[model samples]
Target: MADNTAAKIEADASEIITSPRVEVGTRGVNRVDTVYASIMDAMSNGEFPESGRLPTETELAQRFGVSRPTVREALSRLRLDGLIASRRGSGSFVLRRPDRNIKRFAPIESLADVQRCFAYRIALESAAAGLAAELRTPRDLDEIARALEHLDRVREQGTLGVDEDLQFHLAIVRASQNIFFVTALEMVGDQMRVAMQLSRSLSLERSKVRREVVQAEHREIVNAIDKGSSVEAAEAMRLHLGNARRRLFEGPQSE
Candidate 1:
């Protein structure tokens, strides 16, 4: 499996090298975005190894004719977006395929702005999930449960569940017993609404399987909190948000 994947990746590299090359950093494009897009395209082409082992940083740098730091930055974004996972001694590996049929949406703000919001939420909400696990009352759990129930009903009614989705996140933060966290999120409510609207709209257009995956992610966070595991709760929230970003921006479109 590893050898097969390596050969596929090498083939991709050869194609890129032989193709008419555009100069990097041309027309104000970022080198990191170039490298990131290249990898994503390769993933879309099914070039990843079965063992999920990605090429080393040094190899990727050479393959893309960019510096190691550029490749590193691209990989970091991929990691945060939950497409890949990096281990200290073992290197990075693919977690899943990029969705190929994602319908594009015009962002309410710049795509960069929406992505920046996701970055902030990943940090803030993950922490909130952790604290909620440690400090939640039965009431807090009830609030979260209620929000989730609303999400299901809206989903069943053929409506976009954006408000329910937002409330579910808010309930988790409120469970943290930290008014400041709640305050911080409320201050950014408009941004969150925009982000949620865009993301949920995208999900609504995709397959039922895709929408269920989103719901499953919400359940994972709640289950971790129910178990009172701070570490798992935080990690679940991180993965959920990261996956959400990927689903909104990187997910495959309909066939």
Candidate 2:
């Protein structure tokens, strides 16, 4: 009750401070964009994550001395970019992240070379999973949720066509918030796509495997991050990725 009243007052104050009308050719920059930058910076630095809850729209309006509409506009941008998520009654929470890796590769000739490729990647990616737990932003977590949801939908409705094996892991790399890491992973996407198509055909059971287990791996990665355990996150990633690689190489007798 008290929070609501305070919020209303703040909103009203913000409206008064921000004029409704704007000049057709104003030269100055937007104040709301400045507010937006600060809010993003705050999230980027893990301030909101450490605090454990973001301020209400009105609280933010009060803080930035901007209209409620202006603050909403800024938040809306964040929401669209997969940075923040909203709930009806409860406030938003930061999403968990899987570890990621940062390594570039030269073009490979065949699946044999990809074996070493996956081996080297899992090592760094698992550790990255741990860092993601420690450093995941709200946006990062949101992306994870969206990916898992997509995976489930795909699993229920159809397969990732035995070709999109990289979709789920790609989402994980993005969650790591390391641009270099995600780009490095992208480099081998072509080889991975080919390997996946081949692996699926070899192991007819691959498509039938319940995604519940794969989704479970995602949760495990998130759990490690939620607990702030980087070491555990990395080990889990190593084990998970190793399993994936084994399937690729030692998979049911391939041509």
**Which candidate ranks first by TM-score, i.e. highest?**
1
* lDDT (Cα, tens digit) per residue for candidate 2, span 1-255: 334433533453464355343212256656555665566556645577632567998889899877787877666645433456678886654331101110111221233345545644664476467667667878777766666667567567655444334665676677677888788778878766765555444444543453455556766776666576666666677667666554443322221
**TM-score of each predicted structure versus truth:** 0.63, 0.49
Q: Who wins the lDDT comparison? A: 1
Query: Which digits, one per residue and each the tens of the lDDT, describe model 1 over residues 186-228?
Result: 8888888877877777777677888777888888999999989
Task: Please give the CA lDDT of all the candidate structures.
Answer: 0.76, 0.56
Candidate 2, which segments miss by more than 4 Å at Cα? 1-109, 161-165, 201-211, 249-255
C-alpha RMSD of candidate 2: 21.1
RMSD per model, one decimal: 11.2, 21.1
Q: List the residue pairs that clash in candidate 2.
A: 83-139, 95-141, 99-128, 99-129, 100-128, 100-129, 126-234
Worst 10 residues of 2 by lDDT: 96-105
lDDT score, candidate 2, position 20: 43
